[model samples]
Target: MVEVRHHYATVRGHRVFYREAGAREAPTLVLLHGYPSSSRMFRHLIPALADRFHVIAPDHLGFGNSDVPSVDAFPYTFDSLTDITEALLAQLDVTRYAVYVQDYGAPIGWRLALRTPDAITAVITQNGNAYEDGFVPEFWKPVWAYCENPGPQTEPAVRAALSLDAIRWQYLHGVDRPELVDPDTWAADHHEVSRPGNDLVQLALFRDYASNPPLYPQVHAYFRERQVPLLAVWGAGDEIFGPDGARAFARDLPDAEIHLVPGGGHFLLESHLDTVAGYVRGFLTAAASPA
Candidate 1:
């Protein structure tokens, strides 16, 4: 079994925790997780890919094992989160690496790609969105409303949406085999969100997500210009992102690979670990090869 080591790096005065595995000489693969979850989400995937690639999975500030600064102390915007992640990578001497992104990770990964297009070797997205076409109106309605008018009236709804029940729903909603998904996933997430003042941090991020849509055109333009090797493996049944998000990549990067797992939910790794791993191993092997 491949061993995964946990470590923390001081980035911008915050302790950013991350999981690392595989040999240092191996090509790097950075894994960025989604909302209410941390590097913990990659526990299985890290080991699976560690044999072929050096894996780095980090917990963004305000989530996972990272320092949970009070909402007032940190901006909690995607841009700030990306800054911390980028700094952490620089500190680790990671100059070039492929990125695996999901949910909130999408925005952060895209920002990194935009900032340093030359640093990105390839892109892998699982339920990570870039285009407006990816948004499921019903799933994003309340979030869109709150982003537009973030006031006392809209705050309550957004807060409620972050509740433990909602977190659980995100895990089991579209999975064909809910029992296969570990309950500990959402339980750990709930524990983090339940921390004092963390709720406000999450709420702030939900509002700041509005900042991402405006950057979609830029992301699309980057895709067209760079023509980066992209593999979009998504959960077809994902209520939040849906299959269209995966297919959308093909529009920009014509050669991009798109696969939608049947009945795989938002957290596709939970239910389809081996399948995703297989695809990733094959894609990265070819993408990382010398031209």
Candidate 2:
């Protein structure tokens, strides 16, 4: 095992914090975490895959220890996040990497793969949206409503979503094995999201996500046109996005290899770290192995 190194990369004026491990020349596994949380989501999987790959996990701006500039200072759009992610990867000299998409990571990863289709060798999605029919929770309704009619009223919804209890519920709601999730994990997410004006980032991003409905068609087209191999690991129990959404990936990406985790949630990557890592490594290795 290699010693993990924490560092910073200035992107769009945010000192984006990240952890880099594994040899520079090794295959890179780029991790895109969800909103209201940061690279911290990948804590368990990072070490599992580090020995075989260069794992790069960054705290998206306004999330984790990364920047939290005023919502006025930043757009908080998924497109903007995609831009920042691309710039950071290029600046770091990462080439031909596999994207590990989880939660909000799906949208960000979709935009990245669209722009630089060739840069991606494969994609591994764990409980991320690639299909349209997956189960979505009741909590997302208010946020979606606000996205439709964004205004000062949207502020309350954002505040509600970013609330400590709300975030804790999102992280731990569907876990079959509750003990696997440490209270500290949710504590850290709740704390980071509680930062001043941090709630606004959540607001702005979710608002922009309302506009994201159109992008999915484009994303579907890109996957079809590029034939990018995808391995979707879904926790059927996820309250956010359900089994139907997981199967939806198979609709657009007919060949997308799907792994349905019997009991997992938004944090399935954490709960099924070894199984997910094994599936991902196998996909990457087999794809690159000329078979």
Candidate 3:
């Protein structure tokens, strides 16, 4: 069994927490987490992939075990989050690597790839949006509304989206075996989101999420321009970013591989770790070969 190591790095004066495993000389895979969750989301997948690749998963400034600076102190926009995440990779001397992006991780991964195009070896996206078609109007209605008007009066309606019940719903709603879903996932996510003043942090990011769709053209440009190796593993039943999001990649990069896990939901990792890890490992290996 591969052992996962925990460490901290001081990036831009903030202590960044990350989980590392596998040999340093191995090909690297950086895992960027989703909202209301952190590197902890990759706990199982990290070890699963560590034998063949070095895996690094970090918690953004305000999430997980990392520093949770108030909005007053640090801006919570996607740009700021990506900046800190990129800084963390630089601090660790990780110049070239494949990144696994999910949800919030997609924006961060795309920005990192664009900023340092040569450094990104490949990309693995799981339920991370890169196209307008990925956004399900029904699920994103309340979220977009909050993004349009963010304030004290409007906060609660959007904030309800992050409530404990909602967090649990994200895990089990579309899953086949609700029993297979770990109770700990929502527990940890809820704990982090429930932290003092963390609601403001979430609200800030939700508002910033509006800034993402406009950049879809640029993200698509990267795929067309660089033709970066992409492996998309998606939960087919995800009500938020449905299977359409997975299929949308083919329009840009016809060669990109797409795998849909049946009976999976938004947090597919929780229920489909072994399948994802297998797909990721195989894709990376195939991508490394001569065409």
Candidate 4:
């Protein structure tokens, strides 16, 4: 049986929670989660890949079991989050690894890739977008408005999006088999967001999201220059980030492996664990093989 262990590390004066699995000598695979979720999201996936990989899934500072410092205490930008993640990896003595990114994790992963391009072996993106084409304008309209101008008028919509009801909708809306999705996912997320100051933290991140799109060109340039292996297994039905985002990877890395799972929504792993695990196992194996 694969053993998955949970632990915490104090990086840069904040408690960071992470889940670890697999043999220490094995290839490392870092799993980065999306918004309103934490390392808890990958509970099942760690064991599935642990036999062949040394898996590490971290809950970003404010999201999971990690320390939720006040917005004034922490910048709450993707750069700050990446800085903490990088420091955590350094403290853990992890040097090289593949990254599995989704949603919010995408920007963090990209920043890591840009910082140390040589250390990244491969990238597996599940609805983690970095292209303009990836934006679903209808779903992002309010977010864009808020990003452009943060005030009472736009803040209300953004705040509502963080509500438990909105969070629940995100999990079930495009999912074909909502019955299969575990209720605990959103419930736990709501509990975290319900924290006294967590809402402001989320809103800060939402406003900071405006900083990501402008870096897409640089990300694409990195892709073309490095030719790093990439696999994009996206939930085609994702309302927030459509399949086009998955397809956009091909434009830069022509050799990228792209798969759009029909009927899969934003949180694909909740309903299609087996399929994603299989893809990850096969791709990471081939990616680590001698060329």
What do the candidate models score in CA lDDT, each in turn? Answer: 0.94, 0.81, 0.90, 0.94
TM-score-wise, the better of 2 and 4 is 4
lDDT of 3 by residue, 129-200 (tens): 898888888889888877888777767878897799988888887788889888998998999899899988
Model 2 lDDT per residue over 1-291, tens place: 557788999986788999888888888899989866789877777887788889999988888878888888888888888888898998898868999988788889988887888998888888778655763857577777687777776568666777778877877777888778777877888888777887778777887876555778988898888888889888877888887777778777788899888767778765667778788878878767765
The per-candidate count of clashes, in order, stands at 0, 3, 0, 0
Candidate 4 structure lDDT: 0.94
Model 1 lDDT, residue 90, Cα: 98
Candidate 3 weakest lDDT stretch, 10 residues: 149-158
Could you tell me every candidate's TM-score relative to the true structure? 0.99, 0.94, 0.98, 0.99
lDDT of 3 at 149: 84
RMSD of 2: 1.6
Q: Comparing candidate 1 with candidate 3, which one achieves the higher TM-score?
A: 1
Q: Alpha-carbon error at 239 in model 3, in Å? A: 0.9
Winner by lDDT between candidate 3 and candidate 1 = 1
Residue 238 lDDT in candidate 4: 95
Q: Which lDDT tens digits does candidate 4 get at residues 116-202? A: 898899999999998999999999999999999999999999899888899998888788889999999999999999899999999
Candidate 2 ranges with C-alpha deviation above 4 Å: 135-137, 151-155
Give the C-alpha lDDT of model 1: 0.94
